[model samples]
Target: MPLSAARTALGSATAVALLLALVTAWASGTARRLKSGVLPIPAITFPPGPAAATSSATDFQEPYFPFLEGEVATASVSVGDTSHGFVVNAAQVTQDARLGILPTQLARGLDYGTEALVAMLEHAAAQLYGATKTRLWLGNVGQRGGGDIDFSVSHNSGRDADIAFCYTNWKGEPVDPPSLVPLNGQGQAPKHGLRLDAGRTWIVVKALLVYPRAQVQYLFIAGGLKTQLLAHARDQGESPALIQRAAATLRTPVGSASHNDHMHLRIHCGERDVLGGCTHTGAVHPWSKLYEGAKRLRTASVAATLSHGEAEQRRRALQRLVLLGGSEHRRPMAACLDDPASGVRTAAARAIAVLGGRDDIKPLSARFENEREVEVKIAIIQAIGTLGGAGAGRFLAEAVGQPDREADRLLRALDTVTILRGPALLSVLPDTAAALSRAIRTARLLDAAAGAEPHALDRLGALLADRLLDSDPIDPSRLVQLAAIEAASDSRRLELVPALVGLLQDRDPTVRAQVGRALRMITNFSYGVSWASASPGTRTKGLQRWRAAWRRSRGAPRDAWLITGFKAGGYQVPRLGQKQTWELVRAIAGADHFSVNAQAVLVRLLDHRPPSAQWSKNEACQYWLRWIRARRQRYDLDKPPVETSNACYRPAP
Candidate 1:
C-alpha cells in the first residue's frame, strides 16, 4: 500500500478500536458504577492495540456528562466576593452537540461551573429544547478554576452563568442566534430581524426555577424583556407560584451590565458548600432549603474552627460569620478581638463594624487602648466610628486629642466624625472642635515631606466643616477659619453662605481669597473682583457686591443658585465664559456641594447616564472626567450641548 493509504488505514483502525472499547465497557457495566449527575467522567481503560503506540489511551476517555441521577458527588464551592471570588472543584459543562446548547465563546474556556449550576443549565436546556427544535446559546460561566473572566464583574464564581435569550423571526419561526441579540423596549431586535420568543424563554426560566439540583437566586434580564416574559406566562395560565418565583428572580442587576441581550442566572450555594467556605448574599427566597438550622450548624462550625483552626482559617471563619449575620454571632466575634493573630483580630474588628451595634462601642474602645499592632488599632477605631453613638463620639473625641497620635489614626478619627454627623457628633462638638483645631495646627507645622500623612489636611478640612460650621462662634484661629471656608465650598453647605459673606473682610488676604473663591463656587458668581490680588478698594467693592447678592438671594429657594441657569430643556452655563464653564465642570467632577446636581445636568446635556445607578459618586465623577477629556473641543460653551450615546465609559488602563 502507498504511504498515504497506510496512514488512512491506521486512523480508521484507531477509531474502530476506541468504539469497541466503549461498547465493551458499557456491556460490562463499568460505566454504570460511576456516580450520576453532572460530574467528571471516570477514565475509561482501553485494550492495547496498534494505534495505542501513536495515541494515548486517555484520548478515548469521555468528556464530563450529565448522568441519570441529579446528585453531585463532590459539591463545588464558591468563595469570597462574586467579582473577586474563586471556585473549587468546579465542573465543566458538557459540550456535546446533542445537548441543544452551544458555548458562545468556546476558546475562552469559561464554561466551568458548580455541578449544581451545570446540572441546572443542562436540565433547563434539555427541558426547553426537548419539546422543540430551538437551541440555547450559553455565554460565560467562569474559567476552569472559576476566578475572573473578561468583560464581566460578577462571573468569578461558579454560581453565576450567562445564557442568551431565545429569539424568533418576525414570522414566529425559531431562529438560532449566532450570538446574543440586544432587544429594544418593544421586545424587537430590528437590526437583527428577530423578536424575543417570550414563550420559549419562559420555558427555560420555569425549568431553571423548578430544577431540583439548585435554587435559582437571580435571573437578570432587561426590564422590557422581563415585562414581556411575565405577561406571556400569565396569559398562558402558568401557575401563580411559578410566575411569582419568576417575578422575584428577574431583576436588572445594579452596578453592572443591564443584561439586555441575555439572562444572567445565579444559583444559591448548597448547604454543604456553605460549610466549606461558599457564600450567598441578598435575600434567601422562601423556596430555599437553607434555613435557620443550616445557619446554626454553619455558625457552630465556624466558631469551632475559630477556636482550633490556624490563623487563616480563623480569619475566614470571622468573615463567614459576618456574612451569616445574626446577633448570636456577636459574642464569638467580640471574643476574637483578642485573638493571638493580629490578622484574626483585624478581621474580628471589621466583622464587628458590619454586624456590631451601638453596644459594641465599649469593647472596641477598650481594644483600641491596648492594641499594639497599628493595623488592628486602626480597624478597632473604624469599628467604633462606624457604630457611631454618643459613646462612640465621645471616645473618638478624646482619642483625637492624644498628643502622640499617629497620622492615620487621626485621619480615621476625623472620618468617624463625618460618619457620626448630626446629633451623634454634635452632642460632643465642643471637645471635638477643640481637639481637631489643635490637630490641624500641628499637621500644618509638620514637615511637608513626611508623606506618611497624605490627605491629612483635606480630611481635617472636611471634619472642620462637618462640626465647626454649626459652632455658635466658629474657631478664632485663622487656619481653622480658612479650613472651614474651603470645606464649605466642597461640601456645598448652602446655609453657610451668610457666614462666608461675613468672612469676606477678614484680616488675612488668603482667608479672604478662599472665602471669595468658595462663594463663587457655591453661587457661581465672581462679582468682578479677584480677591487674591485685589487692592483694598477693589476688595471693599467686591465684598459689597457679594453682600448685596446674598441679601437678594437669601429669601429664594436654598438650591436656587445650583439650578440658576438650568431649564426644562438643559443646563446653560450662565455667562458662557471659559472660566464659568470650567468652574461648572470642576463642581461636577469635584466632591463639592452641588456635584450630584452638576452630574445630573451634565447627563442631561450629553443625553447619557451611567450604565448602573449603583456607581459610587467618585466613580461617576471619574467617568464624566474621562468623557469630557475625550471630547473637550466639541463641548462649546456658547452652543446647546449635543447629545451623546448612552454607552458606558470603560475605565482607562
Candidate 2:
C-alpha cells in the first residue's frame, strides 16, 4: 500500500481501539460508579523518608537537599515529554461532593494526574467552594498510562490539567456552567449572555499559587480574561507577592488556541521525577528555584554515582545524566565508553549524543573503532551524526565505505550520512551512493526471507534521496530512482517536474505509479488511470496527459500549480495579490503531500519560525491560519511586517 493509505489505516485502527476502550469502560460501569460516588476518595501518599534529624542535618549542610526530599514526598513520577510522555504510577483524581469538584462526562475515567497536581486541584477547588459554594468543572487530565488524549496536545503527561473558568450572569450571581464557554474580549460569553466572574477566578488562581505541593508552570488562558482577573485581584487588595506570581503564571500561548474557554494548567517536573527521565520545557520561573537548584545538585550526584556504582546502577545514572541535559556531564559519560558492561557503554554513548559538544566527538569515534559490541557501535555512529559538523560528516562518510561493515551497520551509517549532508558527504557522493544501494539490496533480501514489509529500508532510501537530490549528479540506480521519486512527491519539489515527467515511461510499473503520484501532487491534475490495474493503452494515455499538463504548467509561475484547481481563476498569472497568494498558501497548507513545504514557505514569508514540530499538522495549520487572518492588514505577500513578537519571531541580539 501507498504511504498515504497506510497512515489512514493506522488512524482508523487507533479510532477503533479508542472506541473499544470506551465500550469496555462503559460495560464495566466505571463511569456510572464515578458518578454515583461509590469509588472511595483517593488520597495522596508518599514513600517513607529518612528521619527528621537526618533530613534536618542534610538541609543544614546543603540548602538544596530539602527540595528533592519535598518533591519525593509530594510529586509522582511523570516520565518523558508532556506531549509524548507517560506517568509512572499515576494518581487518579476522583470526584468529591464536599469540595464541589467533579470531572465532566468526557473526563470521567480520564482524570489521572501526578499526586501533586491532584492535590493542588483539590486544594484550590475546596478553598473556592468553602468561600463561594461554586463547583469547579474539570476536563481531561490524562489517560491511565498518560499517552495521547483526545482534543489536547500537552495533557499526555500528568502535568497538564484543564479547568473551566468561573462564570457569572449579568446580575453578578455565580453560574455553574455545564461545559466550557469561550469568552470574548469584554469577559462576556456573548452568545450565552454570561460574563466572567473575575473575582472568583482570581480566588482559584490565588489558591493554586499558595498550594505548596507543585509549582504551576503555566496557567494558559485568553488575554482578555487574564486582564480582567488581574484587575479584579488588585481591586480586592490581594498581597503584592501573590499578585506578582499570578501575573507571571497566567499566559496566552502563541501558535495555539486562544484558550478563552478554560485554563490549561501545566506543572513543572519534580526534582525526583527528573531523575526518572521527566523533562520540563519552556521557562523556569523564579519561584521554581528550589527545584532548579536541586536538579543541578542531583546532576553532580548522579555523575559521582556513574563512576563507582554497579553496572545497572551506572546505566541508570548515565540515563539520568542524559535526561538532565548538561554538557558538563559529557566527559564523565564519555569515560564510560570504555566500561566493561556493554549496556553501560551503550547508555554512555547515547547520553553523549544528546548532551555532548563537538569536542566529545573524538572520544565517540575512538570508542567506535575499538568497540566489539554491535549495539555499542551503532550507538556511537548515531552520536556522531547527532553532533554533526564537517568532522562528524566525514567520519560517517568513511564508515559508510567500510567494506567489512555488516548490512545493519552500513544502513545505520547511511542513515547518519543523510542527516549530516554537507560538502563532506557530497565530496564522496559516488561511494556513499553505492553504499546506500548495497544496503537497500541486502535489507530487501533479509526482509524477503522474513516475509516482512520493506518499510524502514524504503523510508531510509527516500530520506537519502531528498538529501542527495541537489548534489553532484550520478547515474541513478533503480532503488535510488524510486526513492528520488518518492521524496519529490512528499516534499513537493517542483524543480523535479521535468525529470519526473521523463520517468513516466520507465519500464517498472512501480516507478510509473510513483511518478504519476508525484505529478498529481505537483500539478493537482489527474488523468484517472488506475496504475495498478489499467490496460497498457490506458496507462500510456494517462502518462501522455500528465506530460501535457507539465508542459502547460511551465507557462505559469513556479508556485501557481498550488492554486490551479481553485475557482479563483489566476492559474496562468505571473503574480498574485497578497490576499490571493495567502489564500492559496492556506489551502495548500492543509493538503496531504505539500503541507510540509507549505509550512516552510509560510515560515520564510512571515519571517517567523514555524510552530513546534511536535504539534499535529492540523494544529500547526490552524495556528498559521489564525495568525495570518488576524494580521492580514499588517503584512504584504512579498514583505514581512516590521513588528513581530520576540517569542514567535527572530531572536533578539
Global lDDT scores for all candidate models: 0.55, 0.56
lDDT of 2 by residue, 1-653 (tens): 23333222221112112222222233333321111100000000111111111223232111011122224533457765676555655677767752333336353456677887888999988888988987777776775445555467677557998888899988889988767888999989878878999988888888888888788989999998899999999999988998898889999988688999899899888765665557667778887843667778878988887776578667767765654655587777888999999768877865675567778889888987787654455456556654556566456545532322332332332322222243322221222232223222222221121122122213323333432343322222333234335434533445556776666666555566776776666555556676745787887787777678767777775456654543332222233344444543444434433444455445656775633222344555555655675687677544322222211233222
Model 2: which residue pairs collide?
none
**Where does candidate 1 have its weakest 10-residue lDDT segment?**
37-46
lDDT of 1 at 296: 82
Residue 464 lDDT, candidate 1, scale 0-100 = 33
TM-score of each: 0.46, 0.56
Clashing residue pair totals per candidate (backbone < 3 A) = 1, 0
* RMSD in order of candidates: 21.6, 16.1
Q: For model 2, state the Cα shift of residue 298 in Å.
A: 1.0
Error of 1 at 618 (Å): 6.8
> Which pairs clash (backbone N, Cα, C closer than 3 Å) in model 1?
492-593
Candidate 1: TM-score? Answer: 0.46
